[model samples]
Structure formats: structure tokens, C-alpha cells
Target: MYIHHSDVQVVFMFTERFIRYIQFEKRYSPHTVSAYQSDLDQFTGFLNNPQKLSPPPPPVITHPSQITHYHIRNWMVELMNQHIIARSINRKIATLRKYFKFLLQEGVIEINPASKINTPKIPKNLPVIVEDVKLTQMLDDNEVFGTDFKGLRDKLVIEMLFGTGMRLSELMGVKDSDINEYEGTIKVLGKRNKERIIPVNNELKLLIAEYQELKKKQDFFGNNSLTLIVTDKGANAYAKLIYLIVQKYLSYISTQNKRSPHVLRHTFATSLLNRGADLNAIKELLGHANLSATQIYTHNSVERLKSIYKQAHPKA
Candidate 1:
């Protein structure tokens, strides 16, 4: 039940180093780095809190080397009992696995304790998407947006998300120079700092030009900010602003409860898959690390086909 000050300090030091490792060396997105740091902090907090364990006193985890498979198992059990979802728990497990792996590589620990932990199976939920017709109707509705800077910006935000299927973070990272008018491609910096080019359509390109022109007229345009998206006040836009913009405009066309920037992404992928786009092509466009992440849209495409079959088949 007792721990030395040196051990605690070592733990904190190693954790900070690990955070920096992922934040900079690994080039993880800020959001992902924050989540990993929080997971590690939570695990460390649980170990330091002896009262959380059951009647039998567990060994004190004062250092990274003291952590073992059993401790990780116990932690997962505790998380399960707290009704934490499997996906979230699995993410925590991933964090621990990486952290311990880093520690092992650095010689801080002789063995990786989280190596043997088994995560619960997460239930598969198909990505939600708005119907293509609905999305088109919404985008084409003139009244939904206006000719003003905010309105044009809002319209283009939805356009960019749907047209290119970039993540919200990537959208925020966009710069005016990233757009290529002649090539009709947008260069986006995605997860792990990987750069990908998404080909946008002529319509979206025109919209972008229009939005830029309006933005140039604004007073904030004089600022040297390279960010493509900006607030009405001419400052750079944040995630919440993008989220609210997508949700508000989407509400005019669809009733799906989940309406966010990601919905537009899903719709983009699903639309592409439904229209005979190759899986590999879709994978490249979405900046997915692998084909597995892109395969989910196939399920949606199959479901769409089934619905069509049920409606058109007369032999039955």
C-alpha cells in the first residue's frame, strides 16, 4: 500500500516522455494525442487509488515496470463493471499497449504488461449516411444558404466534406494554396501527417472560388492566415464551428439523428461505392490507412441494392 517518491516521479516522467513521443515523433493528430494521454492518466490514477480494488490488496504499481498482464486484466474488468463500452475500452487497451511498448523499447520495463490483455468485441454498426438525393436536394436549396460570406462558407464547408470526404481535422487544416483550380484536387494533411489528394468536382471548385472571393472582400482577409475556413469575424474556424455548420445545413434535408461532419463523409463514401467506384479508389480518396476501413461502405452499398431489389423484383 506504500510507494516511494522516486517511483512515482519515474512513472510521471516516463508518461510525459511517452506523450511527447506520440505527439511529435509519431505525428499523431492533436485529438488522438490528447485521448491517448487521457487514457494513460486514467490508468495511472486507477493504480494509485488503492481503494478502488476489491478486498484483496493488490500490488502497488509505482513504476511502469511493475505493471503486468494481471493488472491490465483487472483494469479492464473494472472498466467493464463501470459500463464502459467495448470500443472505448479497446481504445484504452490500445493506448496502454502502445505506452508499454514504448516503455519496453526504452528499457524502462523488462516486459510489456498489457501485451496479453484481451479486449471485448465491439458490435459492428454500419456507417450512417444521408441519401444522395436528399443531400443533393439540400445542397441545391438556395434558401438554405445565402450570398453572404457566412452562407457561402457554410455551403462550401458542406460541399468540401461531401465532395472530398476529408476528416474534420483535415478540413480545418485546409489552406487556400491547397486548392488546385486547374487540377481540381485538394491536398489534405491527414492522420499521421500523411498527405493525400482528393479530386473535387467542377461545381465544388467554382463554389470554392466564389467563397474565396467573398472572403477576400472581408477585413479579416488582410490577415496572413492560410487556413481555408474562417469565422464570420475573419478568424480561423474551429471544429465546433464546422460541426454546427454541417449539422445545421443537413437538418434542412435529412431527419437522421446523427448529423455531423462525419455523416457527410460517410455519405461521400457510400455514394461513391454505390455508383460503382472501386474499393481501392474509395480507400485512397478517404485517406484510410487500409482497405479494411474502407470496406464498411460495401455493407451499406449491399443494403441499398437489397432495398432496390425488393422494390423492383416482380418474380416474387
Candidate 2:
């Protein structure tokens, strides 16, 4: 890839340094680091051929200093021409901004070229939430989930997601030591390695206890596994398996176009907000970095109010 660049060595060297900085100093997750790396690769590919065709291309972008607002604008137009959504384009823009900022800090560039670029505005779509009645019926129906280990585990997985509003990664990371059975609270390791304690009600606590007992009877759990949730073979639960578990059960109860573990998370937040839970409290429980990220749930509350008003008002 460097052979295509005019100042290949400089750009190549600085890009590696930036990757290391984010991985070590910034403590970014692997998934996030991969995204940043992909963005840089895409930009470099664009620079190699602004027209995006094979060989016989224009002059390559060899150094960070060669990038300008005009180049950034052209890249945005190309992405738009390919029908990339505004949200994804905005993310790519953010990646460029961060990369250029890092270059400026390291003295690789005099001015940040991406600093002047504007992010495309994205529409706010309300999160999909499972209705309380449907969720209640599904959880209460033992005939469907059954009394077996897999059945019980699947049921608890759905309940835990809805009950705690925890992310799938957080749920997968839970350990026996993280659950304080006596205090009725579970420690959640959220994004950016931040930890928070979410209180579990008696019902959830009981379900967890039942699952634990069932786990002990099974020979699948080896001595080394400390993860709270495990597969039938006693191996650690993976993201896809958990996703399938949630998807299968939600399919039985919801007619909504989208149904996943995240919908349960949305249900948890919207349920609490509809019942008058404080926005700040929900933010803390969800382990959000800021209140703004938690504010989207308020839109659901407003829509609920509109529905109630339409039903109660007799002006028609």
C-alpha cells in the first residue's frame, strides 16, 4: 500500500503510531480500533484514486500535510454518490477528524485538514421497544420456555436484559463474583471499561439463583469457567448465540420489524421512563457516559403522552 504513496514512509509510520496510541493510551476497544483503521484505509484508497478506479490513477496522497478541506469534501461527495447513509458518512468524517487531530498533535501536519468538514445531519429514529404486555406474557409462559437447563437459561437471559438494561457485552462479561446475591445488585462493566452497579429486583434474583442451581447439576461447566452465563457445553456464551436466543423468543411475542436483545434493553428503559423513573437515574443504571446519550428515551415518553392524550381527549 505504501508503494502507491509519494511520501509513503512518513504516512505509513505515523498511521501505525496513531493506531498504537489509540490502542494503548486511549484504551479503545478492539472493535473501535478496527473501525478507525478501516476509515484510514478507505481514505488512503480514495486518495490513491479520487475517481476510484484501477491503475493509472492521479497523484497519491503521500503525507498528512497534503490533505485539505477540498479533498475531504470530495471524499464525502463520493461516499454520498455510493448511497452511504448520513449516519455512516458522519462516522467516517469523525474518524478523519480524530486522525487529523492526532497528526497535528504529533507535528506530522501543520493544520488539521478535516477540522473544517461538516458532518451530515442524521434523522432521529425512535428506538424499537417491546410492549410490556407481550413481554409479560412471554416471560410468564413456562410451557414455551420449559423447565430444562437451556430453557431456564434462555428465559433468564431475556429477563436479565430487560430487567437491568445492560448491554450484551456487559451481560457476557458478568461473573459469579459480580453478582451480589445478598445485596440484590449486579456489577456491570460497561463501555470504555467503566463499571456500575445495577440493582436487580427479587424476581430476577430468584431466577438467577434457579439458573445457578441448574448449572451446578450439569457437567458442562468446567472448573475454570467463572462466567455467569454459559452454553450447554459449559463454554462461555458468545454474542451470536445470545443474539439467537433473544431473537427466537422475541419473535414469538413481538410483531415489530426489529427484535433483538437491544429491543429488550429499549423496553427496559422505556418501561422505567413510562413508569416515571428519573432520567438521570436511568442514565446511571445504563452506565452511559453522559446524559445526552440517555435523553433519547424521553422521545418515547413524549410519544406515549401523545397516545394517551388522543385517547382521553373528547374534543372529537
Candidate 3:
């Protein structure tokens, strides 16, 4: 039974129902749902467009059979030629594959056209990593002990990023209770809301302890305080706020590429791997869903080998 134009709520209702089904019934993680939501929103928006679907289109697509492979292919092409990154294009395709699989199992469609579509081939680019010396200087560059509270907040922010090697989202989501001084670890919620405990360096532990002391004196860590890193106003840190802090500190050193919170993460992974840290341990630390996703760091090791070979070769 196809959803009709007259039933606006039916379309909305089914979308929510299907999403919930995937979340609970199918055991999809929250991170997985976030990605699926982004893809489906775009997909449904395309189908609802007056130019794409015929005039007086139905609000909800009731029948899974109504979707065709042609539509899926067209979406892929649009993402490709329109300059979307191949990796991102592939991710959107994966989202469709999972959604259509659900529709097939539910008997909504006789065939899964999305399954037939090919994923775009993504090229691997060199991972953006910062030099250890530059990162060292950037972390220690916080001499700006201005009189205002914001200066103290900013100094702590940069130090945490370099110390923890956490993603911007992960850092922003951290809460006060997540820090365990006795354990010398911070509980970080990673992609898909997966939780991992990362050990804190002595410097970071001491710094956070000092900050906590200040926070107590100022009465900032009050009940209902949700964020771990806060602004001078004692609110949660946003992604943009993290970006601005990274930009300011990274400017103090000679970095070749753009410096963002993610670069700090890549730097952390590469630095650890270069220092002989186990790949499996690094994978867990980074919270990668698959080992293949973490395998890109191997390329950096290969590049390092080449650099050393060229420098030491007496004949060359």
C-alpha cells in the first residue's frame, strides 16, 4: 500500500517508525542513526522536489516498491559530479543500502534497487598529520595569562586537545563526571556514542585538577553542568569554539596544512604509531568502527621508511 498525498502524517509517521525500528529492533547504534538520518533526509528531499517527482506528489512513500534503482544511481551521480568527496559519497550509498535492506525484509519492496548500485571508488589521500615539534610548541604556547577568565579557559582548552588527541565532537561532549582523577583517565564518548576511557598525561591531570580548584572557587561546577570544557561564561564548548582555539594555537608553529581538531587526532595516532604503539591499541583509542578505517596510518609508516632510506643510502 503506497502512502497517499492526502495522508501527510502517514509519511512522517512511517519515516519515524522505520528509523526507530532500525535503532531498537535492528540494533543500530546512535552514531549509525545520525549518519542514516543525514542521508535519508537528503534522499527524501530529492524525491519530494517538484522537479524530481511529478506534480501533486504524495507526502510519504508507503510502498518500498515505489523506489527504483534509477533514483539511487542518479543520486550517486549528483554527489560525484557535484564535487562531493568520494568517501562521503560512498558513506551516503552505504546508508541507502542498509535502509533498503530493511525495507526488503519488511516486505515493503519486492527488490532492493539500492543494493544493485555500485559504491563510488574513493581515493586515499595522505592523512593530515602535524609534526611533533610543532605540536609541542603549540601546546606550550599558552603564555597568554591575561587577567580575564577567558584567557585561563583558552589556555586549558589548547592543552586538553594536544594532551588527549580527541575529536572536536568528543571533546565537546565530555562532562565533569566523566573525568576520574583517581584513575587518571577521562571517559570519552566516541563515534556512534561508543564510550572509551583514555588515560591522561601527568601534565593534563595536574592542569585539570588546578582548573577544577579554580572552578570550585568560582562556583562554576554547579549542579546541572553538562559540558566538560566550558566557555568563560561557564557554558559548553561548541565545535566552532574548538576550531577557533586550534587555529589560534596552531598559528604559533610552522604547520604545512590546515590545523583543526581532527588534525590533532591524526597527529596523535601517527605520533603514537611512529613511537611503536600497537596498531590495535591505536584503533581502540581512535574509536574506529573498523580496522580498515584505521589502516590508513600504515601508509604514513611506509612514507617514513622511504624518507629514511633516501637519507641513509650512501650510494644515492
Screening candidate 1 with a backbone cut-off below 3 angstroms (N, C-alpha, C), the clashing residue pairs are none
Which residue window of length 10 is worst by lDDT in model 3?
A: 50-59
- Candidate 3 residues lying further than 4 Å off, grouped into runs, are 1-9, 18-35, 50-64, 104-110, 144-148, 254-257
Please provide the root mean square deviation of candidate 1 (C-alpha atoms, Å). Answer: 2.4
Model 3: per-residue Cα lDDT over 1-316, one tens digit each: 1344654365455567678987787655454666788888887766655445433344556654667787777777777768999889889888788777877787766788887888877788878877877667655655644434666667667667766777777888778789999999999887655789998898888877777777766667773567767876677677778888877767666446587877778878888888898999888888888888788998998898889989999865
The per-model lDDT (C-alpha) reads 0.87, 0.86, 0.74
In terms of lDDT, which candidate is strongest? 1
TM-score of each: 0.90, 0.83, 0.82
What is the descending lDDT order? Answer: 1, 2, 3
Q: How many pairs in model 1 have backbone atoms within 3 A of each other, for residues 3 or more apart or on separate chains, i.e. clashes? A: 0
Superposed model 2: Cα runs more than 4 Å off:
1-16, 53-58, 216-226
Report the C-alpha lDDT of model 2 over 1-316, residue by residue, as the tens digit: 2235446666778888999999899877565788889998888777766444333333655677876887788889889999999989999999889888998888889999898898789989898998988898889888989999999999999989999999987898898789899999999888887889999999999999999888888965555778888988788887888999998998888877788888989999999999999999999998989999899999999999999899999972
Alpha-carbon RMSD of each model: 2.4, 3.5, 3.9
lDDT for predicted candidate 1 compared with the true structure: 0.87
- Quote the lDDT for 86 in model 1: 96
RMSD of 3: 3.9
Q: Which ten residues in a row have the lowest lDDT in candidate 1?
A: 52-61
